[model samples]
Target: QIIEAIESAFGDGPLSGRHVIVTSGPTHEPIDPVRYIANRSSGRQGAEIARALRDLGARVTFVTGPSTTPPPAGVEVVAVETALQMLGAVQGALPADAVICAAAVADWRVANAHADKLKKDPSGRIPTLEFVENPDILATISQMQEDRPRLVVGFAAETSDVLAHARAKRARKGCDWIVANDVSPETGIMGGNENAVLLITADGVEQWPRMEKSEVARRLARRIAEALAE
Candidate 1:
């Protein structure tokens, strides 16, 4: 209701007619009823991006996993847990004008997630586990033949060779742009307040100085507005 009020109040803003879908946080793939596999994404950047878009008068659908940061106001929020759930939520939110995939999805999930917690054996025996690959949400959206968003952006968290990996990811995923950052332990960017990122596009790469994640989101939102306008 608050989101509707905001939209009605600012119907003439730059992104008024635009619809954007943003996927955030780290997806948890369950290994058992109690245990799961997940990444370290705090979902700060993605949440900030959703807020920035909403501030620009865009109708935003924020699909997120188990994020520490709360979902921003003036946007629709869809909470999910696993990679599959995130993908489903994102797809359900489309067909959006733009899609930003910032979720750090687990690469693999336990093929046989036990109904209950597995207990240790008294004979010192260990249980073997099988794995299955999770769906690539970014790639699936980017390569869509119909109902594909006009703009598709993805994020890459790399510890080394940031630009190279980011470029490869953009090509492989078929996303229009990729925001890459170094998340090495020394950089403190994984869960830090500030971030230094490289925006990789087919035209070239643009290195952005370290700044607050909120600032980055604002800049990215402006760029998105411009691109969509063109």
Candidate 2:
């Protein structure tokens, strides 16, 4: 109790005494000893968000996948590869003030991962791959009855009808907000530097101008601070 009090007092910022968890990057679902299914998420935005939350004096726990971008400094980093592992990490860091699910988790994983790489057949027959759905981490956490965060945020990367999809996602996932963005090839938003996002909440949707991912992180962090204050 004394340690907790001292830590909270010394935190000394707008978000002091608050804990935030952010998940970033794409999960790799193994297909074989050498192959895996993954996505193109750069994890830049999530890393920036973690930094922004930390700057606001929040104790940040960053649960991440195999991202090329380095994890942010001054935060507890839990590195994971599969969706299940990521979910476990997030659950372990729970009882947080806020939770952000920014990861591009693979929808399915190999139902029967091979222990060894299969050799090519002389008859040119291809191997049949079976898949199973992965756990919906965002939905699981958002709908938790116990130890649920006050604010739960999710990301919806869409190519068409972004806002509509995001709204449906927020409702389906039961999260407080959804950060929706276009990843259509022309936009160059995915795996790029800048992002234009729509913040969807029960109140309404707010469209943000295209800007650096870091800037978006800062703005979102400020908004989170304001919301938590209220």
Candidate 3:
């Protein structure tokens, strides 16, 4: 409703000239046919941002990982399961004016995925599970040779020193901006309805008041639209 009001006030052409890319949900790293390594992301925040961007008139390409939520209306949605698949999808959805890395991508994947479920061993020896680093989608796109988005925003889920960690993430990933949040066990922010976040950029940091994820998305989308216009 708020987004609708903002769109009406701005009239047309606010974001019509731009293309935005958003990544959402948690990528599942297959461990076996019956199980996988995944995160607690529900994709509510990412979907809201995609919807808000579309409402603002931007052409949005929303890439999602394994999730139960549906894509927002009026946006092109691409679904994938593994981190590798999400990376490929993001790469294919290029020429975007902005890219929002909202997905809780697994940092590592099983080095060797099992084709079948392993049974419990009577000998009581645990099976060794090797892991390998997954591709950093945001970093790859940010450092692209050409057709890179003008602005790249990533999310840093941390427990302590959130702002400091976010700064390091921005520098490490070569992204233009990052949204930092504390996802401590007590916060329940990972898959919750509301959040308190800090928007960090090269210019400075902006601490946002606690609000519903939808509200945050709407505001962020508006900011993104304005930035593209600049």
What is candidate 3's CA lDDT for residue 41?
Answer: 88
**CA lDDT scores, all candidates in order:** 0.91, 0.91, 0.89
Q: How does residue 147 of candidate 3 score in lDDT?
A: 75
lDDT of 3: 0.89
Per-residue alpha-carbon lDDT of candidate 2 for residues 53-113, written as tens digits (9 for 90 to 100): 9988899999999999899899999999999999999999988999989999888999988
lDDT of 3 by residue, 1-230 (tens): 44444457667647775789999999999988998999988998999999988987889999999787788998999999999999999888888899999999999999988999977789998888899999999899888888788999999989999999999999999999898899997998878899899999889999999999999999898888767766
What would the per-residue lDDT of candidate 1 be over residues 26-132, giving only the tens digit for each residue?
99999888988889999999999999999888899999999999999989999999998998999998899999998888878889999989999999999878999
- TM-score for each of the candidates: 0.94, 0.94, 0.93
RMSD to the native, candidate 1? 4.3
Regions of candidate 1 where Cα sits further than 4 Å from its true position: 1-11
Instruction: State the RMSD for candidate 2.
Output: 4.0
Better model by lDDT: candidate 2 vs candidate 3: 2
lDDT of 1: 0.91
